[model samples]
Target chain A: MPVNSTHYLFLSLLLFSIGIMGALMRRNAIIILMCIELMLNATNLLLVAFSKIYADADAQLFVFFIMVVAAAEVAVGLAIIVMMYRKVHSVDINILNRLKH
Target chain B: MAIYDILFWVLSAIAVGCALGVILSRNPVNSVMFLIITFFAISGHYVLMNAQFLAIVNVIVYAGAIMVLFLFVIMLMNLNADVEPQKGQLVQLAGVISGGVFFLVILAAIKSAKPELMDKTSTNIGLISDLGKVLFTKYVLPFEISSVLFLSAMIGAVVIGKKEETKPLTHNGEEE
Candidate 1:
């Protein structure tokens, strides 16, 4: 039997949930960023699956755009993280307390 | 089960397992490695979905470039479990619970909502030629706009990462 779209959707859901847990539970900034990447990957999986199910290429094109944005986001995000480490000497999110009055 | 179904099951299992590993690993470097594994597995799924272009791009962009960037930052910062402080157990528990609930809600919604299944006529839409045609014709505006977004991000990263110059101070009547 061929793989159904529901199977792909469920897989994406599980991956996304794992990402959410990681982002929430991990205090390290790098791990959190990695988790966010996981979530984005999950969405890309879902988009590809839907593109197949609909027999259309629109969703796949959207996936291409998502990848572009993700690359840009990673570049800027890692730079910000590096800056944060330089100032605070730590990568833990908890250490970023200077914003509080 | 058919060959494709079997492939789907195995790849999804690996993807989910690596995803769990990403969150559970104490070392940031290990987590980045797990994330790479997860990306590879997802690319496998893309192949099964007949998205050849996406599968290749996923491997090159995610597993290749992005994960390397993550690993480099982890090394630059010298991050490890010992250096990073952990959150309280209560917060961890709360995160787990919330994530579980969110998963359950989405799963339930998916089960209840029935999506129309299209006939398996052809898989040509996923080919590079078809995707390129669609991307350039209908989605040309967003495609061009994304290039601009990337340009801005590059400039922003440079500005943010540049070293700040320290001003020199002069003492009274002479430089100290």
Candidate 2:
């Protein structure tokens, strides 16, 4: 009995929930960012699972595009975090009250 | 159940557990580790789907490259275990309510989702040769565009990461 698409969907759901929990609960920007990545990966997994189940390459191709976007996101996001850390001396997102300006 | 079925269940459980750890862990480093485990588990899922190339790439990129960068930056920042501002009541309530709501919504959706019928001829192109052929023949344009996107991102990252010149002189410098 091979793993079915339903199993994949459940995994994606669980992963997405973790990401939501992290983004909501964590005060650290970096951990939140990691959670966001986890969420994106969950979606990608779902796409690949759907593709294979349908015998379609389009969704896998979409996953490829998603990976490219995720890579770019991390690069820019980390740079912003570094710059933010410079001014605040901390990566704790809760301390970012200066943004109220 | 067959061996693959057993492996699938075991791996799925580990993946779900690690994913939960990513959210529950207060330590950022520990969260990052949990995220790594999630990546590995997803890669295993790709393997179960017979997308061998995708599985390897998933592990190599997410678990290998991205995770290392995350760990390096976490260490470089020398972050303390100090609690952040507004860490008391409001955030906890928001976390619980939002997560619970989202989970309920998704669970409802999953319950109603129509089961997808598996392809009778899945053409298990688990081999690199077949996948390469399809990719080059049908998905050539997207592939090329993705490369260009990567190149631009590389340049963008460099520009963004460059240090700002806030001071005209350094400690040992003599400004003209």
Clashing pairs in 1: none
Who wins the TM-score comparison?
A: 1
* TM-scores for every predicted model: 0.93, 0.88
Model 2, CA-based lDDT: 0.80
RMSD to truth, every model: 3.7, 4.3
Report the error of model 2 at residue A1, Å. 8.8
Any residue pairs clashing in model 2, and if so which?
A: none
* Candidate maximizing lDDT: 1
In candidate 1, which residue ranges exceed 4 Å CA deviation? B80-82, B115-121, B167-176
* Model 1 agreement with the true structure over B1-176: per-residue lDDT tens digits: 36777887899889999899999988888888888988999888887778899999999999999999998898887775456788999999999999999999999989865554533566888889999999889999998999899999999999999877863565654432
Q: In CAPRI terms, where does candidate 1 land?
A: medium
Query: What digit string (tens of lDDT, one per residue) describes model 2 on residues B106-170?
Result: 88888767777444354666457777887898989988988888888888878877887874675
lDDT of 2 by residue, A1-101 (tens): 45567777877887788788778887889888898998999899899878888787767767767877888888888887887787678888867786597
For candidate 1, lDDT tens digit of each residue in A1-101?
46676777788899999999999999998889888999999999998888888888999998999999999999999999999888778888987876794
